[model samples]
Target: MMALNSVARADSFTITGVNGTGVTASISNYSLVGNQFTFTITNTSVAPGSTGTITNLGFALPGNRANNFTLVSSTNSNYTIAHDLNATSGSQNFVSSFDLVLIDKPNGNPTFGGGSVKNGIAGGTSATFTIAGDFSGLTADQVAHAIFARFQAVNGDGSDVAGNGTSPVPEPMSMLLFGTGLAGVAARARRRRQGAKE
Candidate 1:
């Protein structure tokens, strides 16, 4: 006999500005199923004459030990997000860099200095982007705890924001086991019906 359980969970959050730039960000429509995660992020400026750019975005997996995170999809008109690298050590962190450009600045406005810019995401106007990835490295006992995102503007203002969200739902192995159990039950039912017919 086998006991199988299936759980589905989803979560979302709004990111606060820590860089004194009056820029706000939000993550919505987040869902997790069997090690797959997806979410959307929207960035906007609250104050006038304020423009910014996103430099980096990352997610923190607390107990997971595997580093096989892969970006599945992304959609945004203003910015481009690309997978950067894993963290140094022991911190199951996945990072992605943003391609954004600043526009119409005074003489001393800050810039990326041609170091990390990629696809030219502009400020002042609102921009929204979505990202989906698979975290197959997580074990049955390990789960994701929190999500972190960081960004910077042309004025040298930046923020590293943390948001709370739903933890990893179920392990892939557990899902497989549950499927096998269901198949076994179906097979037994068919056999019983054939025996009675004979």
Candidate 2:
């Protein structure tokens, strides 16, 4: 079997959700270069000062691949890398389907058997997580159909986000294109609002 960091490639996939308007997430694989892998969740449903939190997120592993379980870090404490997220203390979903999970806490949860729901990922922000380890044989397909849970301020106070899609690797160009598209959409809406105001 090929070990991780053997090749430098990025793969990306879409994560769909409900009870919220236009909520989505993405996972970018970049482990082949010994750099890092990231998962970003964007919630665009809740208004300002409202609370729309992503409490749980799980990624599946195709062909029953093993988790390397190395290091987990993020720009903020909103999320912690929990290859094995815990669900006993607080609450979590998708323990059997998803092979990896980015949890709200990461003290002893280094394996994907459970989960947590503390200070979950916030809404209206692009919360990105950096996870490192031996993810040899991991591909973009594994993350295509992601599953997650959100709480508060959504369509009737949050719901589960789950679905599947293509297995295109998260290339930098692809991410840029996606980001640009989102920006374009936002700009158009902003202009429309401005026009309405005028």
**33 Cα displacement, candidate 1 (Å):** 1.4
Candidate 1 lDDT (Cα, 0 to 1): 0.43
Relative to the unseen true structure, what is the C-alpha lDDT of residue 94 in candidate 1, on a scale of 0 to 100?
A: 28
lDDT of 1 by residue, 27-106 (tens): 55555556555555555544564445544454554443344454444454333333333332222222322122221122
Candidate 1 regions with alpha-carbon error over 4 angstroms: 1-12, 76-145, 154-198
Top-scoring candidate (TM-score)? 2
- TM-score for all predictions? 0.46, 0.52
lDDT, residue 45, model 1: 43
In model 1, residue pairs whose N, Cα or C atoms come closer than 3 Å (at least 3 residues apart or on different chains), thus clashing, are: 100-121, 101-121
lDDT of all predictions:
0.43, 0.50
